[model samples]
Target: MSQNDALHGDDLEKSGEALIEFIKSSNAESVLRGARGKLQEFFDHHIKTKKTTTDILNDLVHAEEGIGQKLVNLEGKKSQMMQEIEEIEQELQRNLSRSQILDSELEFLQKELERLRDAEQEIQTMQQEVDQDTTEVIPSAIYVAQLYCNVTKIKLELDTEPHILRGVYYGGDVAVPINMDTSTRSPCEVSDELWSLVNTEW
Candidate 1:
């Protein structure tokens, strides 16, 4: 029984009857004394055991609470990590999209460059053909005639004796005169190829 029950309950009457029996019976005194000593030892050990059990139970409860708090903290950290992972995935997708756009732009620029190179090659080929045609058009005879007339006019103007060449013509165009007085001169004669060179655009 608990200490409170032994002090306040019907244990008092039972305790008195046991004391009377112990005095009336022969050789019961020594046996009762020994039993009382043993009972006291039992109560002392029980109380010690109960206190130790209570302390252990309290320690277990505190340990459980600590473990619960740690679990909650771990769950929060896991949630934050998941959120970070999601953000990283989104950033990677954005980078991939930008890379695709750059690839498309690069492809377009490459096509434009190829087209420009082709056009430049065509223009160079056409220019070469025009140059070849121009080289074949001017005749050597027309070039010599123009040069002879130009030299004769320069010599005539620089000569101190102008009267000595008034009636004679040494070097001049047979059809078109080198002088500005060309009223009585014939029309200039030129090769058909030279005429095309002076008149044609290409």
Candidate 2:
């Protein structure tokens, strides 16, 4: 209950009468001054609250601008990173293509080398066969002379098996074997007279 509500009967009447008397005796200037002071306090409190609100709004605006700038920078970086990733991917593709081409070239080279090796082996085998045949059938000196006469078109005389000569002749009725060293001589070491005789006969 209020204090006014607690008062009753003569107490309420006396309080009412005293309040009326106080109101009548109060100075007009003092009453106006008191109201002005209260109004000033209320306006001061309102202005202070409005200034705090304006400061908070300014701070919020600055924070928003900072966040926007940061977002723009991050976006730029993201774009750059994306472009780099694309470049790297393109480079990887090119390298893979080059590697594939190199692999194909290597495969072709390896096949060519194998074919050449096979051809070389065939040639060696044929050469060995020819050598074996030549070893088995030795040519006679008369056959060799006939061959030189046919190929070189020169009437060359040669001895049997061992001492084959180009131009020298040993006149005998019967076959007499002469014991001499049968080593082969280079054409460069042969006498010029022999070569001249062969050319003249030809």
Candidate 3:
């Protein structure tokens, strides 16, 4: 109730008039003392058993304050986690970029290795062909040299058997016996077989 509102209304007036009449009809002092006793007892009962609105409201406010503190702590933790997540994402991106560069380099190296392998195979094939050509050409060249030496009447002995040279020059090739031996030339490195074929003792 506001302070401006009247405390007593029409009911209070009638009740007062009746009470005054009763007091005059009976012992007024005794009635007044009994009413005071009843009021005091009622106040004492209310103070002991019932909680006030103010006290309940204060309890609720304390609980709310505790909850608010917990919320603040959680928010701080969440902020730290978010910052850590951002750093991890940045690091992941850098690793992805580095991985991409390594993948490209690996691919290039693989191609270079394949090319080198193919070149090695080609070189082996050329070497085999050169070896085949040398085998077929050597004996024919010796035969030609024998024909030339025989026609010029040059007597060239060799470390090999005489019959072998005779067969190479005369076996269905020339009508007469022939001989030839190639010696090492100056400023040139020659094979051991060629050098040994020259009969130096003869």
Candidate 4:
């Protein structure tokens, strides 16, 4: 009806024709098919990558568990070794104490042995002196007995009685026994050489 309205209707008709032509072209169809192919490729790659990451994470978890178990075993071994070392140290200390005790006992035993040897030597020396005194007394008593027999015209007999030297003077129907004390007080005091000769003759 109006000229302006007629012109607007013609412009709208041209715009709709241009849009229909652009949608029906080969380039638009090719673009749509390429976009669809790219979307499929992206989804496939995402699925593959997710599977790979999950497998890797599972492997890492298993490795960590193995490492933890090894650490626990090592800790147990360390505790065992420490206990053995402590026991060894205690045994060593006990052995050292026993060695010290043994050394002290050995020292005491050596001292006792030395004392016993010294006492034995002292006893031997005293016994030798006593034997020499007894030998001298016997000869002196016999000499006194002989001198008495010569003066009194009796018989003199010399012998050992009860581990001592005895001189028996035999007179007429009488027998008198003379000991060491009687010889020392007798008038005839014989010399050492004469006593030695008497011992040699006997």
Best prediction by TM-score:
2
When 1 and 3 are scored with TM-score, the better candidate is: 1
Residue pairs of candidate 1 with colliding backbone atoms: none
By TM-score, highest first, what's the ranking?
2, 4, 1, 3
| Between candidates 1 and 4, the lDDT winner | 4
Task: Give the runs in model 1 whose Cα sits over 4 Å from its true position.
Answer: 1-25, 122-202
lDDT of 2 by residue, 1-202 (tens): 7766767756978999998888779886688889999999999999999999999999999999999999999999999999999999999999999999999989987886786676567656655665577655545655545444443344543444555543332222333333323365555544443333332211
Candidate number with the higher TM-score (2 or 3):
2
lDDT of 3 by residue, 77-167 (tens): 9999999999999999999999999999898778867865765676566557666776555565565455444433333445566333321
List the global CA lDDT of all models.
Answer: 0.62, 0.66, 0.62, 0.67
Q: What is the lDDT of residue 190 in candidate 4?
A: 33
C-alpha-based local distance difference test score of model 4: 0.67
Where model 4 places Cα greater than 4 Å from the true spot, the runs are 1-22, 26-28, 122-202
Q: What TM-score, computed on C-alpha atoms, does each candidate reach? A: 0.45, 0.49, 0.40, 0.48
Candidate 4: TM-score? Answer: 0.48
Error of 4 at 15 (Å): 11
Q: Write the per-residue lDDT of candidate 1 for residues 1-202, one digit (tens) a residue.
A: 9989877666778778888886777677888899999999999999999999999999999999999999999999999999999999999999999999999989977886786576567656655665577756647555444443333322223343532222223333332222333233333432232222221111
Alpha carbon deviation, residue 9, candidate 1 (Å): 31
